[model samples]
Target chain A: MTSTETHHAAGAASSTDAPAIATWLTTADHKQVGRLFIGTGLVGLLGGLVLAVLVAFERIDAEGFQLLDSGSATQVLSAARLLLTFGAVAPLVMGLAVAIVPLQLGSRSIAFPRVAASGFWMWLTGLVLSVAAIIGNGGPSGGESEMVDLYLAASVVMVLGLALAALSIAVTGLTSRAPGMGLLRAPFFSWSSFVGSIALLMSLPVFIGTSVYLYVDHRYARAAFGGNFGVNNWVGWAISQPFTYVLAIPVLGFVLDAIPVLGRTRLAQRPAANVAVGLVSVAILASLTHRAVTLPWEGDGFFSGLGTKIADLLPFGLVNVIPLLGLLGVLGLTMLTLKSAKPMLAAPLPFAVLGLLMILLGAASHLLYTVEDAALGGTIFEAGSYVAVTFGTVLLAFGGLTYWGPKLWGRRIPDKAALPLALLGFVAAALGSLPYMIAGFADQPAGVVDGFAYSGPQELWNVVTTGAFALMLLVSLAFIGLAVRSFTAGEAAGDDPWDGTTLEWATSSPPPADNFSDLIVVGSEYPLADIKNSGKVG
Target chain B: MLTLPPAPQPAPKRQVFVGTALVSAAATMLVGGMLAIWSQFRADAPFRESPRRGPIKDWMPKDIVVPEVAANMMLIAFFVVCVMAQWAVWSAKRNDRQHAGMALGMTLLMGLATLNAQLFIWSQMGVDVRGGAFNSMFYAITGVMTFLVIAGLVYTAVATFRYLGRGNSDVPTLSAHALYWYFLTAAFSAVWFVVYVQK
Candidate 1:
């Protein structure tokens, strides 16, 4: 009848049974939140992907190029924009990265779980309210003002939550070790997640704070940083700085996974990862200056002047491009070596390859625009480049789920049917974004608020985009159906599915409460590989 | 092949009692103190017939009205909600049906009291520029938080009703949930200081 014993008694249910609602309330277990994060993040991904398809179709046929085109067809496009901007802060990034990164790094609980949970709840609140605000207030306030508040709040909650999650991860990494875990012995995915979590901790908060400032102006009828007050310029800096690689970290994880399997040994240069990780982290922080800002510098004379001079210098921009180039190097290595693997014609492999490909496309496309913007800026071209970010994230999210859902859940997805269905989703999304690139480059009208639709080649571009949409929708339907089936009644899976090369695979298919009965610290990068090739993994 | 180690034996009852007390004290100190300041400032805004001279007005600018009071009260209620929630978690973990039921009831009652106090204050207020946004924000934030608190209470009540009879309270998931309740309570208190008291 002791309190400690009280909470612990209700957990003896079957893994297949639904968790008790109270259990969800009284629990502070990281694993529960982590699983919920994964589930909810995937749900968000599903909703977002479907939204993307609607957007894609609209891009192709803005002027009614749908199978069921009517004036109402525009609702699909409008809905997509609403979803996209529903929260200006990235949901997939905040949701998945914060949720998954912590669990992947072996932690008891987030350092600030209350803050973390509050962050998430408030974010939900923000998005829901913003969407409601948009619905209630039309035209002038619609998407721009009323809807923007919810996202602004979401950004704050996410920033707060993520900072807490990252702190938790770092605390766990720093202090929560069982008997023998060391920095060097940490799991590679966790190591990468550690690095990614740091990037999140530092960068996301600034973005949230920046967005809040912009929001306050809109809310109170002050132009503190929007309108002529410098919202546009400031946003250019803020979004580009944190997000470009708020994105890169996950891709970095996938890249880590891809590299070893192709080489089948330790990374050719393992120390370089630490160095590269640090460099990218700095680069993201430094890029903030590039955001058009309006600051009245205090403290008169030489010292202050030198600071301002340094801010304006190209070295700052150069600092950013350096890590980006290093990341490109990582991706390049993957592309060359991936050909070495037997291309396991399975669910994740194609998606992984395509994901890596879109990342490369996005990197190159964006790099081109940054270096010179006549061909891109605000055009469908820029949209296509941005698509690379979402495309890569979505691909990996779904692909990773498919490749390892069985291992994680102890349940097998319908591989033969589900694999192709998932791949089609990826292909459809990729092809869907392509027309945006063409439209931008061709100088067809772009920018959401701009009503200046191009007169020439518009119809043709619209047609191509609509065609892409048709394919994407079919793919989305297929994926959702498969996800639902897998969760509900997919075949029971076993340990070692996909011959997964990580500590995660070494445990039971769904894993036990403590993760491992006895913690097995790795001495090297390819510990799982050593186990697979020999006998003792982890 | 990978059997987990036996679950750690539940901590001693004394330890649980001490932890609950400590958490409650922290909530009161951290959360209750905030309510007093927020209420003082919220009342002060309307009390000012003309811009008076004070440290806040001098540096804060005359037109700037602070909702320090609204945030203070809301944050206090939030932590009160948290203490009840933790009490519920302690009950649920021990398989004590009566305790769990009592804890949930306490949690809901605290929420209702908070709403009553908030609406009572709102009803007494007159329309003005500086206090309007502050009051609106206060209500919005508290209203949302109240909904969450109620949701948590109901969810735990359901478990108390169903599984308490079954006599199993060892929920692996319960710890995370309790942590979040405490987390939300803590966050609201922290934000009260930042967004309200300081202003």
Candidate 2:
């Protein structure tokens, strides 16, 4: 077949060829698959954010049940965490990678495109079933036994779906790069997606393994792992501190990718930035070891001797600090890049920068939470850190969507409209997290809605956190509205609106069926820049 | 007359091999996590005095005796299975359809044999699923391993049929099939030492 025929065959189906829903249902196009993931992920984000808001509101009084009963408090908290981490963040990040990575690599299509499409549907199905199970009281510490079984089974399906998507992204990065675009030389977003995908692939299976154990032990015999109450004990690590940072691995990629382009500068210290992203994945290693090894920081003999204390603290510190250092490295590199370049005051720039700061702040808080003397292990401070990372990822997802919106859709999100949402997101993230940290420091317990004795002004902090969550809900809704309005009806974005240096910008807005009109063979990391400089195409 | 420069060649797509390697890595970690949990339980299980064997610190209950011969045979079978899987890959690369088919068939047969051995061990031991932590975990670990082996067998069958029907060697699929069996062998090795040999 001729090249044009191949491109046409690989391209997306036209509206005239099939019914719209049918075309979408069977689409192998990376862009369509990505849109499916992103659209579903946003719905999940909205659902999770609503749950978070309810949980926060329930905590406001700190003396009695308000929105939630004692019987349901823990389950709600577990469900919220599950939905936020797995349902929202994982899909959003994976969707961005699915759509954008192939374009960045100058590939005609993503590797195993059908597999990616299958992953989206499977993820959607599992997430929906998980929500149904949660509604039926099937989450961690749930009352209904059968519902618990359904939840466990659904979670496995969900995690495996994400894993399948991760596999496709990792392979695309490995085998789909344009000639001369080596791994290191690939765009930071694609590179980070690669690293992050590998990390998820390795780490998520551990969750799957644990879930299987939990399922069997819970379903047939409650002897090994505790039946319903023990669900979080085995799988909670996937949604918490070090593991949460794993979700943010691709967030760093977005910051790195967007900042350099918006600043109108080639990324300085590109290798260091790459190393920074790789370092964040170290959390995956720490997370895998989490179940097997418990840090001795809480033991009586933890402070008995200097050697013993060092032994106890070293692993804990490394696990918490390394990812923090990684985020710091990204922050430093962004600063260095922005120092000499006159950056465009674009919406994506602040979203990327502030989002990185939120994640950095969260990582820093997690390190502090590890201080044995702080006695913050079971406190709401852990929630504080979780919020920082989770919402930080949300902001980064926002940054990525705005930066790549024109490419994903055929129109750009209005800069003036999107700019304020960045600030709103920062405020929402800060308020949503810092209050929880303060409340945690004040001796308020984690995952408790009420009836805890505490001397510190926990009520005030809880009230503040409720407001923060409310603000976050508003921010999320507004951003979603803006995205929908802009994508469907906004001004048309010409190709190369950002004058992007990467290969993705060399194609038309929203790209064609084959991604590129001609296969782009690159000689440098900045292929478009090379083409423009020489006034020629490869 | 002006002529356009030759269009660049597309990069080779190795999605099958790469995707399989990723899936294999995930499977390895899944089994590794299970083994770690098993080790933890064993380390933490209390020492108990039994009538026949006094003051034993074994994680498995005193009543359960894992059939040593069958378990060992299963391990041996996996080793052979890995070898056969690799032979199929080597044969496929050379377009030797008969040898590849035979190798895949032997791999599948041995894989089924290991499954049979596992089932035999389960029957001989007669451990209840709901008996205790040890019994539950034993079934969990072994059951997951059994599932992976079943997956590997299906993979081998697909590779064999695809190779034969196409009249050409699908080396990537064959290599991926081999890699998965290798992973299964390594995973079962850990299981054997932890759940059988060490116990």
Q: Using DockQ as the measure, which candidate wins? A: 2
Residue-pair clashes per candidate: 38, 1
Q: State TM-scores per candidate.
A: 0.62, 0.95
lDDT of all the models against the reference?
0.51, 0.85
Q: What CA root-mean-square deviation does each model show from the true structure?
A: 10.7, 4.4
Q: What is the Å distance of residue A297 in model 1 from its true position? A: 28
> What's model 1's lDDT at A475?
65
Scored by TM against the true chain B, the candidates give 0.50, 0.88
Q: What share of the true interface contacts does candidate 1 keep?
A: 0.00
How does candidate 2 fare on TM-score? 0.95
List candidate 2 stretches off by more than 4 Å.
A1-7, A11-16, A291-304, B1-13, B50-54
Pairs that collide in candidate 2 are A11-A513
Put down candidate 2 lDDT per residue, A367-468, tens digits, no spaces: 788776677878899899899989999999998999998988979899999999999889989999998898888888987888887887777888787788
Candidate 1 residues A1-538, lDDT tens each?
Answer: 0011112223455333556885564445555555454555555444555655555545554544444334333333333443432232244444444444443444333444554455555455554553454344321223355545554555455445545555445445444433344655554445555666566554544454445444554565442234222433444443342355554554466555644543443454555655555555555544444342222333346475886755644563565466566566666555655655555556665666666566567655665555332545556666666566555655665565665566446686666876676567566657656767777777764434223366567657656655655665566556656866885688776666656555556656565544455455554444455556775432
**Fnat per model, in the order given?**
0.00, 0.82
